[model samples]
Target: MSTHSISLLLVGIEGSEFRLAAEMARANGADVSTADTVDAALTHLRTHGADLVMIDICLDAISFLERMRSERLSAPVIACGIDAPARLAVAAIHAGARDYLPLPPEAELIAAAIQTFANRMAAPIEIEALVGHTVADVERELILQTLERCHGNRTSASTILGISVRTMRNKLRTFIEAGIPVSPAA
Candidate 1:
């Protein structure tokens, strides 16, 4: 069963592709709507609440998404397009999109992404939920990358990461709890 009521607003020009995508999403039990242009979409957003908004990451899309963020739309959006560029993907995520996908996405991929987004939206945020950084996720990645850069030298890793030897040991303890294996260098 789906985790949440899946309603979506698909923003793209009127075309066979958009219609097909809309049908595909609806077939997966999503309540789907369409907006042929940016202004129309923004107006729709003001009146209707949707779980997701899948948009074409075209020139108009870039502008539309920026405006959405500036206007503080809270619905999680997923940008979709044919051969979307890496920078566009980064920009979309930064603009508060939950994820981005290529056009005509596989059924399973679409379903999985929708499920993941729903789960994430429903999950509670907790101090303990911060499994990264203070939970040693960031520190561990840095340690691994730095160790790799230092040719597996603990002293050099410490210098690169700007942490003392004892601090590194303390971090290792947290890293162990985070389930990251210590590199042989440590």
Candidate 2:
């Protein structure tokens, strides 16, 4: 359903089911590749850098996930299995699968999972940006409060912050240069 083309790797799924799923993914603008084993899947992943990976639970999903993690693959992985029990799904999730699907996976579910992964990937960057901004704001406020509590004494503020007096002066200078108002030593 996404306009963006996703490069997907499929592991341990075959027969008409694989073909059907592959075809559906292709129709939804995904470039999909299939592998019959974990090693083969890893090879494809290392070489092609897939956007997403779908692994069958029968293929040792946990091991595959471990390998991917060890190799530092950033692609999101979805574990799928026919008649997969709740425990198996839990295991897949615990093993680092981003999502799980019952096989043969429905095209709608696959699309939704991929979209969810995309959203998840995007969220972290935004969250990190916000966190960085918030941390900077807190740092500025803390430094100002420390300076005020020290009665504008750089040495005392530095000691309290566990920083050198020179470092404290440099930080205060930075604030002043940034147009932040600071009270004179009293």
For all candidates in order, the CA lDDT equals: 0.74, 0.77
* TM-score for candidate 2, residues paired by index: 0.63
Q: List model 2 lDDT by residue over 1-186, tens digit each.
A: 445667878886568364466776776667889998899999998888888888888889989988987998767788888887888888887677866788776889877766765555455453454465677687787778988997888766665565777887787799899999875775
- Tens-digit per-residue lDDT, 2-100, candidate 1: 657577888888874655778777777778899988899899998996778888888366677778878877677778878878898877765556567
Q: After superposition, how far is residue 59 of candidate 1 from its true place, in Å?
A: 5.0
Best by TM-score: 2
Q: What range of 10 consecutive residues in model 2 has the weakest lDDT sum?
A: 121-130
Runs of candidate 2 with Cα error greater than 4 angstroms are 16-19, 118-124, 127-186
lDDT of 1: 0.74
**Residues forming the 10-long window of minimal summed lDDT in candidate 1:** 129-138
